[model samples]
Target: MSEFLSHSHPRVALIGECMIELQQHANGTLKQSFGGDTLNTAVYLSRLLGSAAQVDYVTALGDDSFSDAMCAIWAEEGIGLSRVQRLPGRLPGLYCIQTDAQGERRFLYWRNEAAVRECFTTPAADPILAALPEYDVLYFSGITLAVLGEVGRARLLSTLGDARDRGARVVFDNNYRPRLWRSVDQARQAYRAVMHEVDLALLTEEDEQALFDYADSEAIMSAYRDMGVSEVVIKRGAQSCLVRADNRRYEVPAHPVHNVIDTTAAGDSFSAGYLARRLRGGSPQEAAEAGHRLASLVIQHPGALIPRSVMPA
Candidate 1:
């Protein structure tokens, strides 16, 4: 675990875009909600940590009813709204999810003009960028990089470097979405830009392979290791997760789930579980176990968020 989180009640900030989610049912009905990669992780992390840590979501949302609803939901989940920004005359992005018989999900997005695209580019963002360094942990994903565009991304990179210089741990999740970028080379360049400041990397094996063209998991791990990341976790759905922490390696098996429903936030929940356990002083192996346990339960549910009542104890 990173030394920044050694203190009790460490503060965490997750930067990304949260969109209006429309879950398409088999009967052609759409169930509306809110979800995003880092947002999903923030909610689950807040739930897992309870009052043990402070989780704040950093993003810009429109001054609309949907945005208001999003804030209400995050507050209910115990996520801090102090870092969230509200912009006028814009709306949050929208996405629709269609699930297959195998519980695999496909998404169609309408986010080109979302308010979060200007999150780190506006004048109001200066204070948020200045305050980010004060947090114990800073978390973001590849999708965040893609959505931030060039200017926003450049500002974010500077903030990340500053945050790291202040002894804060930077956690990166490789939630790659090819549709969000102009080309693979552009995505590669963006991802490589932030690698230097990342303390912990939570990557999906398939996404890593797709993003960097790594032959296998070993190559992916070797690449991040060479990038100077202190901790690396490879999440392979239904298979074992690979972890490299404290110069030690471990392969933790995933929990078995006979029933499959929706695989919306499996990886996000796993990251939340892993970070929650590791930050609370659990071993790497124990953290991976917790990740697997939570992920297995998430995939058995129907949306990005499962009912709080069904959460694991």
Candidate 2:
């Protein structure tokens, strides 16, 4: 159904923040880059779908050198920048990634004062919110909801409703971070409010367990069905991804990886791959395969954005 909602040349708009990323290497050196969950998904989707979709990112950033560089890099990846908001004298958020010997990653964030917290509250956001319904699809994650606060969350809910009414597909990813929200109850309220409006949900099993404390995958799937989500995909790392669509279920196994260098952006890339295939008129099973394939490759390399040259054909 989501695939059928788009025109021949679909326009995809992802709402979230991109932060200054610093990664520690084995040699005790730090490598700088820019990445966020939605941003990573946007880049990979742009690469995979190519001319099939017009991918855009919507977020607020400071008018600083880092922001400028981030925009330029996004443009180089062929992501649209028409919805990006530049707040004066404000800086984008920053985070550091440290990976242990097992390739597991940990992050330390400095984003309390990031400009994206004001994404839908500023004057410039009026146009961005208004323009959201014009896109064929609107993609956002749990983190996007957390940073918006109460006021901005209300604004977002209104916009999402309007967008859905205008025949736009609303896609959500459950990338839950417990530390971002004030309390579990508040987070659950926000998630429940938006769940009813979502057309497709890309959920992680661990996140669902952490947030809603579901007993198992069936419980999570039942919750999503009750929320009126037409399509649901549950991603389990190194395991199978379960897809429920068209009143049928499909389980696709994760692709095998010989070496795991870094686990960063694995789920983000998987969502991108799945969305890219779905937008291109593929079935749920096929989308899951594509997602697993891409994620397997991502974990074999370091950082969020892997080299374009190494992209699978």
Candidate 3:
């Protein structure tokens, strides 16, 4: 195994929000569940690692019943909850997903008042922020940056820097949602602040082009290289994913999925598979393949999380 997972149980902390998800069907009925980028990755990571690693989620939630249900779900998935904060008089975010015939999804969000907006800004978060640097790996996404706002992002940036200085690997998934940011420039600023600390960047090709206006995968890889990121994985839907690691470049093809369903958490699950395999000492090639495998399975399902019973062996 890699030195990062050399211990009996490697500890990983994923920071982001988990919202109340409502899947709208053709009949106009709503199927409610819980999902988020980092949270989805945390759940899949916990499942993939099993007893080999400790995966914790770091975010603030409401003291409402929805938050309770969310915690129960995370606990059942074997994810650590010590870092979760429940604030009084607040509620978790909510969003509705509508999928088309091709399994593409559209979302309508009502998250402005979500408790996670105050994630790293509360007094209770001081200790959590201090403890973050002790983990073996720290993971978050572009959506995480957008939700945390200015104050929270500043605190998270400092914590990430501290974590990297202590030899912990920082993983970033670029899941940019333009609606969440005031402007593209503001989002760019926040992303740049965290990019330098990232050890592995799991970037979606579309998001990169949308966020940075990068002409192609090469430009995206070149930019991260200049920022001193050692490992970069560009996730191109359907096409081969590009991996640049240890001065080597690879093109790992995506797993073929015949029947497409909801594409809600495809990238999140991909990040989880890639990180889980890498932590277990798999090469970049192997890790990317694992990612493709998990993502292929996820996209066939109807929600962000499929039945755990169907998890890949």
Candidate 4:
């Protein structure tokens, strides 16, 4: 049974940064939007679950026009902003995406001084940190760890431990970006510190290899299992995704997408779908299938977010 199914309306909080996204078109045009790995998942999860759950985003953003716009959009999607902190005189990070002829996207970031770097550290953040353990589920990604500097990361680790002790399920996604961290060793250490407390781990095989240099899929699963993660899903692009939980392993084939316009938020959307279904009392196999279905539709579009009308039925 899904843990969330026991509650009337599960409260989910996803902690990460949402940056100003500038998508460079082939015709030399730039389109502005807001996107981040965990933010993408938050939006998708809110969309899929609707009033079935209370979805919230936990991050600090500047009291600026861009931040205002991002919050407006998230509110339109029905994502709660009670946990979002608006810091004065600070600004959200920015990133630009350039896609090639083959629809492969590359990103350039300007996030060194983003307001979210002070996410869990500032004086105003004390209450937010205290409130995190009250949520039924807390979701974050590797990128979340990277943005929260050393002090913030330490605070997050202590909070996660307390959250888990209070019976809150901790979910993690390995959305690793090498450019975000100071060093591989530092990233590894930070990841390991939180892994022991994670209940469900959504991993990308490529990231596992890049970060840990795992020999193969089995090694990655074994490493996560050793860290005490109860559930692990290894996402392999264009191939089947593997899920291991309760000492059983299953492989669900990916939904085929013939026209891949852009693969921007494939993994993030998959995580959202999987978590949505799993939270709604779906089996692990059903959750993986939901993940593939949403990811297939997402990659057919050009940007991270597909239109609300085109959502999978």
Best by lDDT: 1
The digit string of per-residue lDDT tens for model 4 on 83-198 reads 99999999999999999877789999999999999999999999999999999999999999999999998999999999988889999999999999989999999999989889
lDDT of each: 0.95, 0.93, 0.94, 0.94
State every prediction's TM-score relative to the real structure: 0.98, 0.98, 0.98, 0.98
lDDT of 4 at 185: 100
Task: List model 3 lDDT by residue over 1-313, tens digit each.
Answer: 1232455578999999999999999999999999999999999999999999899999999899999999999999999999999999999999999999999999999999999999999999999999999999999999999999999999999999998889899999999999999999999999999999999999999999999999999999999999999899999988889999888899999998899998989999999999999998888999999999999999999999989899999
lDDT for model 2, on a 0 to 1 scale?
0.93
lDDT of each residue in 1-313, candidate 2, tens digit only: 4454546789999999999999988898999999999999999999998987899999999999999999999999999999999999999999999999888999999999999999999989999999999888999999999988888989999999999998999999999999999999999999999998899999999999999999999999898998899999999999999999977888999998778999999999999999988888888998999999999999999999999998866
For 62-114, candidate 1 gives per-residue lDDT tens digits of: 99999999999999999999999999999999999999999999999999999
List clashing residue pairs in candidate 4.
Answer: none
Which parts of model 4 have CA positions greater than 4 angstroms off? 1-5
Count clashing residue pairs in model 2. Answer: 0
Measured with C-alpha atoms, the lDDT of residue 151 in candidate 3 is: 97
lDDT of 3: 0.94
Clashing pairs in 1: none
Which candidate would rank higher by lDDT, 2 or 4? 4
